[model samples]
Target: MATTLKNRSWRLSAAALLLSFSAQAQAPEAAATPAGMSGQEMLFWVLVSLLGVLVLALVLTGILIVVQLRPQLRKVYEMPTVRPSWSGKVLGLFVGDPVLLQGRVRDEIMSGHDYDGIHEFDNDLPPWWKMGFYGTIAFAAVYLFYFHVADAGQLSQAEYETEMKQAALLVSVGSDDPNKLTDFQPLTAAADIGAGKSLFATNCAPCHGAAAEGKVGPNLTDEYWLHGGEVNHVYKTVKFGVQGKGMVAWKGKLSSKQILQVSSYILTLQGSKPANAKEPQGEKDPTATKIAMR
Candidate 1:
């Protein structure tokens, strides 16, 4: 019985020792988890290693090429003692091979024609500069087609007209921005003038005449003025009309933008001829935006 009990006790001790060893192995495996890598990290390292290997192979190939050509290069050409940078080697790609004359390559690119015994080689334009010139030509052709023929893009004049329309539209829609309120910007576009022409014929033509040659009011086509001939002054005169001279204020009846438009149109009438035109009224101002009454 004692012998059997002792064997059972020894077996129990061996089992406990095995459990301890198993626990230690399990703990180390759990601790290693924080130091583990994800699939992306593994892929990144693999790609980097492959790139490094490829770069190494290319370097080795370049070294081999240099070694193979060294003997020929030493025999035929005079190479610089100092080594060139990798960037210089990259620039050499565009520059082509070095000359056998041991001088700058530009010195060899002389014109073929000679003057006063001065010999000249062929004049070849740089590929980069020629490419830029060709690119500008292509751009000009595309611009002509797109803006003039196809009408796919806007020209400077077209863009100006479009912006003016948008601005006037905003004003018509009752926008109350201070910039728009005090806006003295005048548009000389034909469409803008046409809109103003309609307003003028309906309102001011009784006094100013259809051709702005003046009836009861002063001649607008002449280089003479009642108030002033500057753009902003013209706009102001139209806005708050000269009440004492039988010119009624149209501010309440017309929009500020409409008044400005008519003012710009009136400026365009300078130097125009009309049948039975009224005589000029006011003194000429030097600062007037005039195109001379010719």
Candidate 2:
């Protein structure tokens, strides 16, 4: 009976061993991955994100370093306090220490004179001014060395001439076209006749009646044209007075367009009856045109 039990136990052990081998054979193999990241892509992404954060942190640290260092760099370039020499020291003792001398001198100079104990010193320029003057001389010497002798940042005569020529080219007047004339032609619209009327009333009303009837000057309302009736010609005559004629040219005072508008307004006066119309003086207009001045 004991022998039989041992055989059964051995059979059970062999069966268990076979079952373990089968399980091992059936298991899936792990896939090969670059950088040993297989099956842990999430962890890999987390590590990559951390690296980017670290790079950004480094950049911010660099910027902060630059900002903190700037003021220290500026201090490096600032002027240092100057120490007085033997001569300056001696002068300071007699004139109240150099540091305090400025205030003392200023007080003495500004203090009013008294009748019994009268005393006053003329206001003098501060020591800072003298120092500044010396500094200016030093700077001028340095500038002369750099710009004249060393030729550093200096403009040659040829370069200066070229620059001047370019500037002249930009603004030089090239032609006498009417469009180029900037001084004349202040008004150009037909509606500006009202403005012309005002001007005529103020200036021409004394010679020619307010109604433009002949008075000291020839009748303007009549068709008898003294000078050319054209607008341009009338503008010219108004701008430049006719030689030996009473009309004087108003070129410099009134703009060309203003003169033109006034001329047009005058044409509108043709044949209009005024309160007092002078008898016809010059040759009548061949056109026999009639216009109402209203």
Candidate 3:
């Protein structure tokens, strides 16, 4: 009776140990899941992969359809051939092949002409050249049809004026009035003056002279001033200008800052004497403040 009881207990213990081992094996699998990636994540990746494969399959199928259908469609719509003369074939080889060159066709014929011992073969121009010539004719016809006959895009003088007025409204331009002059203030920094000097050399040197000694205009180097000598005044004069005096208003032509830079550059020219200074014009007031243009 006791042996029977011990055997039953051993069997129960063995079964419990086997179940614990199974649970332990399953616990590792549960713990192995990454922080961000769960079973749902794995399923999502698998679904994405399947979708990519499906898309690739669809693209391949489309390419196959196009490859199979193109030649059959072309065969169905084959164009009739226009035969050329024997002389035309010979000329066609020298220019490009007629089939290779679009729309060029040969129609004229030329036979061999023999004069004494000399023999020459006369041939017509390639069909390609003829077609090109004909294309120009067609283009002219179309252009004339659209421009003159249809008059779809034609603009009347009033319409053109209206368009010009609208376009002019979009742009900000300085006043055209000679009496209302624009002003440019000089930049004080040496770096700014240096940049302005370079700019003047490139842009203003032709008319104003390289050293700012007036060639077509007044001298900037000398204290004897024609227009106002103040920094802001000079800036304004440089930007706008004396209307009848040949100095054009550079307001729209140059940016506000660029004009200021040029003004600053002109200021640096003071005291540096150039060879031929234009005789100073305008009254020199004794109380005229010496303003730094740079």
lDDT scores of the candidates, listed in order: 0.67, 0.62, 0.65
Q: What's the CA error at residue 152 for candidate 1, in Å?
A: 75
Off by over 4 Å in 3: 1-185, 285-294
Among these predictions, the greatest TM-score belongs to 1
Per-residue lDDT of 163 in model 3:
92
Ranking by lDDT: 1, 3, 2
Give the per-residue Cα lDDT of candidate 3 at 262: 77
Query: What lDDT is reached at residue 209 by model 3?
Result: 86
TM-score ranking of the models: 1, 3, 2
Candidate 2 regions with alpha-carbon error over 4 angstroms:
1-190, 287-294
Evaluate residue 290 in candidate 1 and report its C-alpha lDDT on the 0 to 100 scale. 45
- TM-score, prediction 2: 0.34
Show the lowest summed lDDT stretch of 10 residues, model 1. Answer: 96-105
Alpha carbon lDDT at 30, candidate 3: 47
Put down candidate 3 lDDT per residue, 1-294, tens digits, no spaces: 446645555555555555555655666554555678979997687567656655665555545444555554344334333124444444343333454344343433335555775656444565578878999999999888887799865557758999978877776565443344455445778777877888889878887788888787777777767777666667777777778888777778887787778777777777688887766666553423433543
Residue-level error in angstroms, candidate 3, position 253: 1.9
